[model samples]
Target: MTNQQLLTKPIGIDVNQVADSSSEEATKAESSKPELNSDEGLPLLLKAIIEGFVDGVLILTTNQEWFHANECGRRMCSQISQGKLPINSIPEPIWRVCQSLIDSREWFSDRKRFLEDEIKVNKSVEFRVRVRWLTLDLSRDPYLLVTLEDQHQSTKNSAITDVINYGLSQREQEVWLLKKANFTYEEIAHQLYISINTVKKHLKKIYAKQKQLMQH
Candidate 1:
């Protein structure tokens, strides 16, 4: 079956439908599985899901060569390179950051070193970029994953706005809101698209600010 067909297939059987059935009947029903072209279809399904992401997904080799790019990533590359896809075609600031990481060689050991910054896509547009090192098997060739989000978009919610009223910076507000939601520090970092160290920094600032307010 095609990727679309595989995606449209029911994910799991309904428990309610089997609630009234005999144990043997339910077992027989569970044994009946949908035909999936797993070997060939899985990659296509993954590609479709990655391409569907709003943030651009880009993969590059340690040497800075383009390895893969989703649809959104291609659009970002086009904006930066004017339809070209060469190594030098990437915006200078982004390339420099990537080069620095590659040069340090520390990322191989400290793979959690994720970088986040902004890059101007054009005279009127800019994008927030997040870069992370992906540790794959040495033989598979290591790659860096870059995700780009439009800077103009608002990631804030009402909870974040409430935190902002308490005199926190936007980043701090994000951290506070996630903390209020009971998200762990690592989960907050992942959800906010920031590094764990950055999350700690935000929390530190937030605590200091909150303590100062409490003293008043």
Candidate 2:
């Protein structure tokens, strides 16, 4: 994929639209696999979105066959795309990205962890490759969602938790969240029905804990 192409980019699978086709591919490997279909309507939308992506978006089938690929995704489809050039051959950077995932799977066949790589595509472009495995039904192998992005900016979103992570106690966390929500010390004191001094003390300790976390 070109640097300019890595700028743009769903999980559901279609039950009916994909069922017959999935069964056929499932048979290609001489396996009796139950379908891992997403709801009919949702996956159709998903497939459309995935294929419409300018960024690389690929859906690995339960049998590791190519289920869907956008223009950018075709670049790395080589992992199984045979000798069809881009599909048959992956970019060197993306090759390592895929290798990490395959290696992790080989190391711990049962346990799984997400695999990722930030690879230099060119002097002007770096790419971040990410692969996430998904659930599958009986008689099938698990599938993967693969994405590629240019380094200028990351498209992947980091999940934010409602609760702040800390070694702080439950009450301390409560105080911290309140403070984060822009509650004043005196307001928090009234809400918790604690003395203003106690609120200040908790805030002090919370700041200390956060500082400690930052240090580590």
lDDT of 2 at 167: 69
RMSD (Cα, Å) for all candidates, in order, is 15.6, 14.8
- Model 1, 1-216: lDDT tens digits are 111101111112222233337888887766653333354222344457778898888767777676667887778767766655664256565666666656655534545455666777663456777666654332244577778886544333455655865688777877887776557989999998999999998888877877887788
Question: Which candidate's lDDT is highest?
Answer: 1
Poorest stretch of ten by lDDT in candidate 2: 2-11
lDDT of 2 by residue, 1-216 (tens): 322211111133323332345766746644533343354312445567677876687656434455556776675344333344544344455555555555666666653565676665444345677766654332145666778775443321210132344566878867766676556889889889999999999888877876887799
Clashing pairs in 1: none
Displacement of residue 165 (Cα, Å) in model 2 is 30
Q: In angstroms, how far off is 107's CA in candidate 2?
A: 5.5
Residue pairs of candidate 2 with colliding backbone atoms: 8-55, 78-87
What overall lDDT, based on C-alpha atoms, would model 2 receive against the true structure? Answer: 0.57
Candidate 1 error regions (>4 Å):
1-42, 82-89, 154-216
